[model samples]
Target: MITLLRSRRSIRKFTGQKISKDIQDLLIEAMLRSQSSRNIRPWEFIIVDDKKKLEHLSKAKQHGSGLIKGAALAVVVIADTNKSDVWVEDASIASIQLQLMADSLGLGSCWVQIRNRMATDELSSDQFVKQALEVPDNYSVESVISIGYPAESPKPHSKENLQYDKVKYGSFSKPFYQD
Candidate 1:
């Protein structure tokens, strides 16, 4: 698992290949099994595969979104705020799980943050996704994950690139990077 974690990289370019139902189910299962605060699991997944919808979603944000149009599918992670106070954290965990699972399945995935962000037209990113997907008002969009077969291969993060300087022994004052 550590190796997998070390090698995982965000894939922003994808091929025209399609993902099978089994793979999609596995990714969903990963999210469903993710740990959440108090185990409330106050999250929902919205899968968008339609080309036009994906195009619309690509425009939902000004940047870090164009890749969705090439991805085979996009998973919109959402949470019911009323169901859990830590809904954002819960949804975020699930999103990472989904990305990791995609990597395990030899697929590629990248996360596009939506919560507390704005679209190109000044509309809230969450609201834009809700309007596009017809999501209920009770739920808030946390992120949108684009998944597909990668077109560009990115090298895994090397140990030399690790930010060990950010580590602290016990408290913030003891940071490894004295400077």
Candidate 2:
């Protein structure tokens, strides 16, 4: 688990190769297994592989979302707002689960944040995506995870570069690690 964590990196560039159906099934399994508060299981997912739709969704945000156009698969993470008050957190967990599974299966993935962001000066990112995907009312978009074989490989983050200061022991002042 630690090795996988140490090696996983957000991959934005992907090859032209397409992901196989077997691999895609595994990713779905990973997401469905995600633990949620009170087991409400509020999260749901939409697998987008249509080229035209992927290109359209690439513009769902003003920035940080163009990678979807190149991904072999893009999973839109959404949740039923009426099912749980913590739907955002629930959907977020499923998103990462999908990404991590992709990483483990020798694929690369990038998380595209959608909630509270903008598609244009006048449109909210969530609304834009919901309209494009035909998501039902009362459901909220949380993220879109783009997955494919990596066209570019990024080095794993080194331990020394980790922000140890960001972690505190019990309180804000004391350091979690002793030098």
TM-score leader: 2
Quote model 1's TM-score: 0.94
State the displacement of the C-alpha of residue 176, model 1, in Å, after optimal TM-score superposition: 6.5
> lDDT of all predictions, in order shown?
0.92, 0.93
RMSD of each: 1.8, 1.0
Q: Which residues of candidate 1, in runs, are more than 4 Å off?
A: 175-179
Which lDDT tens digits does candidate 2 get at residues 1-179? 78899999999999989989888889999999998999999998999999999999999998999999999989999999999998888898889888888989999999999999999999999999999999997899999999999999899999999998888899888889888
Predicted structure with the largest lDDT when compared to the true one: 2
Every model's TM-score: 0.94, 0.96
Tens digit per residue, CA lDDT, model 1, 16-44: 99999998889988999999999999999
| Cα misplacement distance, residue 150 of candidate 1 (Å) | 0.7
TM-score of 2: 0.96
